[model samples]
Target: MDSETTIREPRAADGGLDLSPVSRGRTPLLLRFTLFAIFFFPATMVIEPLGASGTVPTLLCLVLLLAWLASWLWGLHDPIPVRHPGRLAISLLLLASIASYAALYAGWTGGSTEMTRASADRWLLLLAASAALVLVTAEVIRTMADALQLVRALLAGAFFCCLVGVAQFVFRVNPMEWIQAAMPGFTYNGGDTPFQIRGSLMRVAGSTFHSIELGVVAAMLIPLSIWRSLTDPRGRRWFHWAQTALLVFAVTTTVSRSGILGLVVALLVFVPFLPRLVRRGLLLSAPFVVAGVFLIVPGFVGTIASALGADTSDPSIATRVNNYPRVVQLLDSHPILGSGPGNYTPPDALRILDNQYLGSLVTLGIVGLLATLAYFLLPGIAGVLAARAAVHPALRGLAGAVAAGALVAAVCSMTFDSLSFPVFALLYPALVGLAGGVWRMVRREADLRDDENAATARGAMMARAPAPTAKEVG
Candidate 1:
């Protein structure tokens, strides 16, 4: 072909690159693959059908680590930016772990020989996952529009879990039995109490390993349902009502007082700015709560009466009250570093503390406990700030809801169980992402204001300045 006839290469100035197709096509595939790895690995490893632990969870984690490593490698061409807000805090946490390990190795009394390298791996994995998510997601999806997709994904994921949880309650089955069959070594601890006013109802755990895990799932969904009701188009308003119903149904079945309290706390956090949404959301949710009462109210009353009246002579409540002093006594012995990570004895383990913050101090010491609090509270503060300053109605609602959910769960989790489960682990990091996104939105608005001011200043200076004259110049 003649040189003149040859197709000319695109130039740098003319809308240089067309990455629309590439970006759009690649994103869904990558995200789907990542989610698959995340959900599959943890599910299978712990149970079986989900994987051994869960193929999806395992790969999702590994991929995130690999992505971070790749960013380091690419730094030779262009250095990556810092995105992790809790980097300093997380670093201190890791250092504490190492220092504790060394103290135990040298002469510390509370250290355990059973504390293997695997314990270190567990903490490191969480830090790695948190750090990686902040980095990869900041690049892959930077805009508010992009972040909303993540919010939607979170809502959809929670909804699926809630649906399954409700099904478990109605059907009295694990539902994900194929995966459970593969992991025969694991035990199912679910049980329904009878001889009460309420019918026997299965506590819905869904894909999670415990009923409390289901509660965490419920708490996260409540905010999204409220957000949808407020910001969604009028035509789509009914969808939010349906979601509210689902959340109430699932939450009631879990029969967790902590979870119920969490729902109330989450709503309270957002109600000041979103009273209309709050009112509507609650109205939609009330029926499901009532339905739950109808199904289990009699049984619940009997159970409560048995405990309050001491009719059954069960020591569960009394035993927990009795153990509080013992736990306090034990805390005095290892206030700084605790008994060491993974250092719980059978007695300590069997105590059933029902308190995450106390349990953390007992197991991992003050350092871990503080880190846990910081992790939960930081996003909440950031989220509240976002809600206060949000410009778009939809984004504001979503951020506010997520923030509220985190706050509720933080309070509820502290009283029920330590944040050791995968559900809590997963939700915290996701909330961190949402908070970071909100911060970016706020920052961008500030930048825009600054730009507008600068432009006005420039125009005013030009208008006021005298025009140069030839005679004056000469």
Candidate 2:
């Protein structure tokens, strides 16, 4: 039958493809919940006090974990079939994290109370949840269209945060405080504050608990927005451009040097993947646009200079430099399985390590550090490889966007404890999962096409073959 005839064929009475309104275009309920959780991660902090001591993000993660497990156990009718990747690397990573947590718990000689240890255990749980997120997202996103939809959801969340951040920056107001006031026991501290001021400008945090968190989210969104703007049809391009503009403004208003650097790295990673003409246009216009920005916002230019350590007197840079040696010393003390997760920095120090690599080393030790690196790096590499393999332009573009987002996470990790922050922890792995899913979908389509082409070629050969001669038949 022709393709159109096959598609329109009615379902068999034995319960085949159902074209009814209830089934048509309907997303799985579990998948819907997972996407909602991912998009609203920032609001998790508001529900921190609702569930017995653990933060709301963790609780939500637990809910996701349960949902994923239940779906697996009950075989709840999934529309997209899941393809599992080789699990050796992921298994080893999880094993290392668990081993390190056990060692740390057993060798607890520090003055921290039982409550502290309990809280530290949650970090281990978060690690497991992150792994589960990768698996779940990989299964849910089954096509290039699905991947783009996921990106749009992420961008929408970031756009909302940007709007709130801009308002906070301009009006010197924080909506979180009002939410806290109206809702008893909802204590969230991430907002605009005097300490977030850089030079003469105040930084805005939006719904996240810190300006840096908002900055990181905006940085990650910038490249994705750019990719959408470049790849989308002319009719829809304006929406992506608007998202890109908002994300850029949000990043600048946060005054995060790391965020700015991360954006630069992301753009660098993304530009090569663009169509040649688009790439050339972007490269040509970038310098003029940058100059215009510097002229319009001199303060932002100064902040960038300071972030690059151009100002010898910038205390933040000096502070980070000074902390490196201290972090190294801590790592040396617990080199194998460092002091334990969340125990590297003492209350006396009055600051957590700003560097994620060092923080992992000091807390989880060498084994944990390696595992953490593998967890972050493997999926990112897979995404880039997938981008190279994709035959469809839309699939290739989505894969490139995923890789760019991963690059943002990588660059930002050097300057912040990215894994510890829910915004990065959740979004990064989810994007990686989405990339893997898209890759699988593309491969499946290619395989099916190849099969069809081979079948057609064989049929053509048979038709073109000469009939047996009468003598041969006799």
Candidate 3:
């Protein structure tokens, strides 16, 4: 295949990054796999094989990692990545986990002695694989058009998840049970409780392990759906808008505070970046949308409201508060690089902590906690700043949505041990990876514009130069 084949040709200033071998119309084979992986990973998150913690998506992640490695070595696409904003941050996170594990084995930590090397090793491999996903994704996205396509793919994936959740809500059936038939060894991956209730309403889990996980994932995708709707053609806008509505409805069904936190954070990050009229339209419609959902699911809004209003009386709230004393003791034993990440095993080991930050402090220690914050926050802040400077409407909207999604992950961390869940864990890192890739493309364009200006200035100088004298020939 000729490398010179251009599909949708990019403008000299802002389409293809120099390192990206992907042309505008062409989806590189790796990226094709990436998109497919994104689509099905959400749906596969519910099944654990052989009564152990595993999913098809987990195997897919390993496949993605190998594909990226093959691409890097075979030079079928970009021989090297031009930028690595996501990789740097993700690598820091992985390094922190390694340090915590090393500390545990060296007897420098206070975690359980019964903790096996295999568990810690699994955690490390997952982190490394997630980082590779970020690296390869950032390497492939070449233009605003590519970004928009990626957004559509992501929205479609979200739709699949939301649809499953909707089925549970409206039809009282779960299609995930069918997967169990194909893979006889597979079992439900969520908690002992398969479902939950709020008032008279049944909480929906979608393709995720728990209702809260589905809600948080829905919250993260809503901004991207809205951004896609705004940027799509007028005829196609309604389709995307309907997706946005579905995502919102899905989140409302969960009645999970974590999901609510993520949705609010997504909107807060997204709305300010929107054009004035668009922003105003969303703000004015907010109450009506709430009213509409409340009308559709009669007791849901009241259920969520009372859940939010719960003080010390809430068992969930009380559990989180009571865990602090134990966390403090663990932190005191190993102040810098606490016990160990993924070391929390029940019965003999520590139980799950509700807050990711507090959990990180107890498990990963101070350095690890900082790495967690940096991984979740830095790329998002950078994306928002990049969006402000972006000239293309497509690029601007994509950047803003990326920022909003990342912020949702960060904010939702305070509400749950988010990293413990597979889909959210994988999706959040993938968002960071996409941000890095987009950042590299944007930087490439800026550098090209600079070069063009420099060349133009040199040409002008040559054209303006005085005629050479005959004396120079002597």
Candidate 4:
């Protein structure tokens, strides 16, 4: 059978792929669970027993990983794409973590290992959980239809987050606090309240713990949302575009310069892949979106302008500058594996290095840092390859969008301590995993098509050839 035929897919009234679960197969429970973990059990809510690393989303990810493990072990599904570069990179990253931890104990870090021991272990566990999330996502959702399902779920979660952010920034009402109040046992991790005001504008974090974090999350989602909107059937595109606009507007609510930068980066990565008409339409809409924001939020345009124009006097800028020397000095001491993860406590290390590359250099060190770079970048590179090779439009769109998200996540790290906030961390790997998976599917499609073509050629050659003569046969 041709690879384009999906047993579960059904056409929708809009003349596009129906996004309902029925169209994505009956047994994509892990995808559903992953979405549920994103929407209902946010990354902020931690159960007491599991400690700080035991946020509902994190634990749920760990659960999903275990479920995938059992299936793999029991031979319930196809074998994992073990040879994929992203998977290999993540494995290398984890191994690097183990090496770094051992190096710490070997007194290579030249510190009292006891002080950083437990913290380092916790970081290792978190890294493991992060790997689990990325791997399971890449393994489980293997088809275009299921990939669309994942996209829709992520869009919904991002949409919901944007709505909450809008309400917080504009309406002065926060529904997340209500959920927090009702769930007595669950406390928010990262004890930072994301409510701040800048020149009469409310800076809100939405489901994320910090406003800057929300900025990158919005930046990451905008591309995916745009891909969905543009690919959806004619009538439904507006709704998705509206969702994209909400994401854009939500970032403005944060009043963050990095948020603006993320938006710019996402657009730059995503826009080039669009068709001419779509690209023109997208470009033309920007002014209207800006006008809409200005009309709705009054000073939003000025607020965003002010944020973008912020100078070195801004504390975020000043602190980032100060970290350069500190990070360089630390790198001199333990350049290979540095100190183990979580050993860079704020007080002991002087201050947090918000840069992901720098912190990874200090904590995970050079070898682990290279592994970390591979883990973040390789999947997106694969997606770019897949997009170029893709025969199907859906696969092309998914690959492009996911690639944009991964690239955005990687660059966004330059601005802040990105993965420390589970929201960004969660979505980044999901994007990475989804990219890797989409690439595999595209490759499989190519392989299947080649086989079909080869068989057709053989049949045609046989048909064209004359039958053997009786004398010749004798």
Tens-place lDDT digits, model 1, residues 1-474 = 321122323322243221121122122345434543333323534433332223345447557758667767877323234443434334555666655555554546445464433453455556566555544544444443355445555556666666666666656655566554665555433321211122344455666656666666677668767666555432356776777667766666666556667777877776655656556766787676766666653465444333335522445445556657877787788777766554554465347766767766675578867876776677677778877886555556766886787687678766566345665566556566556655665555556656767978999999999999999999
Candidate 3 matches the true fold with a TM-score of 0.86
- Which ranges of candidate 1 are over 4 A from the true structure? 1-55, 76-80, 84-92, 101-110, 115-117, 182-201, 228-237, 273-323, 345-350, 457-474
Ranking by lDDT: 4, 3, 2, 1
Error of 2 at 412 (Å): 1.9
Q: What's model 2's TM-score?
A: 0.83
| Residue 455 lDDT, candidate 4, scale 0-100 | 78
Better of 3 and 4 by TM-score: 4
Q: What would the per-residue lDDT of candidate 2 be over residues 115-152, giving only the tens digit for each residue?
A: 64765666766766666666766776654344555565
Ranking the candidates on TM-score from highest down gives 4, 3, 2, 1
Model 3: ten consecutive residues of lowest lDDT: 44-53
The residue-by-residue lDDT of candidate 4 on 1-474, one tens digit each, is 443344554432223333332343332666656664664455657786666677777777778778778887899876544446567767888888899899888887877366588777767767776777677667766655567667777888888888888878867787777776766788766554559887768889887777888888888888888887866432366788889888988877888777888788777876776667888998998898878877877777777776667777877667888998989898898899988876787773337788888888888889878987887788777777777787666667677778778777788788888867777777777777777677777767677667768978999999999999999899
lDDT, residue 9, candidate 1: 33
Q: Write down the RMSD of all candidates, one decimal each.
A: 7.7, 5.4, 4.3, 4.5
> How far in Å is the alpha carbon of 176 misplaced in model 3?
1.3
Clashing pairs in 4: none
Number of residue pairs clashing in candidate 1, backbone atoms closer than 3 angstroms, sequence gap of 3 or more or interchain? 31
Cα displacement (Å) at residue 66, model 1? 1.6
On lDDT, the candidate that comes out on top is 4
lDDT comparing candidate 3 with the true structure: 0.74
